[model samples]
Target: MVELVFITPFVTGLLAFVLPSALSRQLLVLTGAVHLVLSLLLWKNTPQAWFAEYFAVTPEGLLSLLVISLLFFLISIYTTGYLAAHGLKSENIFTGFMLLFLSTMTMVTLSDHIMVLWIAIEATTLASAPLIYTHRSGASLEATWKYVLICSVGIAMALVGSLFLTFSMELGGVTSAMSFSALTPVAAQLDPAWLKAGFIFIVVGYGTKMGLAPMHTWLPDAHSEAPSPASALLSGVLLNCAYLGIFKTNKIMVSAGLSDFSGTILIVFGLLSIVAAATYILKQTEYKRMLAYSSIENMGIIALGTGIGGLGVYGAVICMIHHSLIKSSLFLSSGNILMGYKDRLIANTGQMAKQMPKTFVAFFAGFAGISGFPPFGIFIGELFIIMAAFKTGHYLAAGIFIFSLCVIFAGFARQVMAICFDTPAETGTGPAADGKDVSFKEPPGMIWPQYVLLLTSLILCFFIPDALYQTIVDAVHAIGGGLQ
Candidate 1:
């Protein structure tokens, strides 16, 4: 299983580069099927799975691999239909990079060494740059440039942190061994000063990539400009990759007796990210940009849950899964809308339901799911977060949480009303697209993928498995004391 996964993506990536468009897409879809099947087989054969020095599955790693691989498969299916509709069967760069992204993510999820994780994570930033500029539009080029520059610099700090972590081990008279499971046992013996420094740098580095507040400036621009498929991968899968790095490190921190330090940092950034989203979403003119802010808000909530610990971490895991599903659905549906027509002001696009009812309903429903509607996965996750806040005696944080959530809902709802419901013009106003005639309906290619993704998210809400939640609980338990 390990060799198949590890070798398949790289080899297929090269094949994708040379194959005809039809063949390239076929290769991707084939790989996706194999991954989906392997994921299922792994689920049935669940045990302490390992591949020498290269890959291993802790409980957390297993879950990460499963979710990411499954999500990648779904996204690839959507990409196929999406590109074909646009008459772009598959460019060499496009198919090659898709495989590269998959390979990078697989490397990240399967990595046992902390340094290997860092390397794989950085590679994502590099591989995704071309995907961002795939359109070759000026806006896309600018966005891609910013993404590369910012993420590259952020990842450099992660490298520095990696070095510090290595130095801490060396100072403890430990050899260069750096497997997570292996290093974790001896974290307590590491030097306090060096370990603390390493943790801070690591957070700063990964936090940038994770779109944590203050350092998250590039996210909206990139998401708004990139192709919708790439945007979906960025929000739905890439952020999770960064989050996993933080999770692994925090696990070590807890063992080294650094709970408060790590927790406080997470809480501060999480709250700031939420606040940033609220402020941005209130008047975000661009529909795609609005979704970008929504991603930031979701990332904030995830971090908030992680920072609070105990039940909060478990809640975070739920939120992570829920957010991935809903955000991708939302972005894909938004792409449906955007491709049909382009506009900055939501008010300009009118009566979406009349034109593309299926797309409209899917977009609205996705928004509702992301906004924490009842029976949706996010609602369950948020409910857990609220419960955790109360249990931890954090009345202020709880109050703020509810208030911020309400504000976010109101802001997004306002936009939904404009784009999804209102008439095209305000009274006797001009056309939605710079006074040019435009269509209300989205293409079939666009609508199908979104519907599939939306239904998948809704399904997650219904089948909330105890085993899944238990894995999260175990992962959170590992975060206890943040490597104390």
Candidate 2:
């Protein structure tokens, strides 16, 4: 019955492919609502999967499930408005694939078996591929191929890594079930050499999907080319699904007393990602692409925090939740800007305060939140991470983290100001030049989802619900990570 959380979406997705366009659109929202209710129910009283060998719930997975559920629901409402305005071709295809994307990501969060987790992650790449190509532009086509090809290669490596885990078990003469829960207690008895090798491959593999550096090339292109709603899901929750894979594997490594090895690698990768984003962000042109790089930077921060452990893991989990909320809202707001300006470049889309006041509020607030400004959960999360890094004696790494954040914020703020307030020259070419023109009418549906997401993040910053706070603590407790 717990599987219904994903199954309902999967079934409706298939039906969406054949249903009439109008009905399919309605089905998308309906599915999202139903999925959210089911996810809440499952979370309320953790239920065992019928196929316990392949699926089960944990604190981490439940946390991811709740985020994915809420995001998809709000995004569904926004998509209904987006589709009507854009009148995209193959609406049915878009609806169906979006639902499928949700289902696959849900499965990834719930998967207990290592191979099953890999399968679900790979399925997410496949399900989201069509969504990226929905625009059907040459650029979109190219981006789709890059996403599929790169992610496919990365996931294949993950498969090999999963096999290495099993091989470690075989070499040690331990015949436990292949589930994470089953292997973790006996992980210390497995071959450490093979376990280390497996962890390396798994990190590089899923790290690609999670948008970590060196493997994050496909991410910007995919996010930039995908429709806004799809972009929301991609940056918002899809990356978290991939991170869950690494997190679970890291948990096993800690149980095996390989924490030092695993932690160091994560820290290195985390800093690399953050530094990489800073380099590109300073000279970025496209707004959506800028947001994409920001995601890479945030993922880096999460990795760094997790690697630091103790308070750091708690901070990383907080960053993960806040990032999902804020980034998704930013992407949705970008859609409004895209609709009004008919351009992706910040230079051409100036004077948003006058052209799209409502969107400006959401977009600018999201900008502040994402940049670690106060009154937002990310500010608290970042603060915790910085303090944790210092407490762990990662002084150099902490310096790099703080410096990169400053650099990224400076570059990001400059572009945002141009987008929000700069007046265009009287060239009669860009929309901003024509002071009287307002291309987008600012739909209530599109406007409100973003506000809701940002408001939720703001509320959580001041007061996290007791259950959610406990869940966050529970998630990190296994790996020598907790508030206490």
376-470 in candidate 2: lDDT tens per residue? 88888888888988988999999999999999999999989988998864543567766657679999999999999999999998898898888
Worst 10 residues of 2 by lDDT: 424-433
Per candidate, the number of residue pairs that clash is 13, 0
Top lDDT hit: 2
Please list the C-alpha lDDT of all candidates, in the order they appear: 0.80, 0.93
State the RMSD for candidate 1.
2.9
TM-score of each: 0.93, 0.98
Residue-by-residue lDDT tens digits, candidate 1, 229-286: 8888899988988988888888888887887788888888888999899888998877
TM-score between model 2 and native:
0.98
- List clashing residue pairs in candidate 2: none
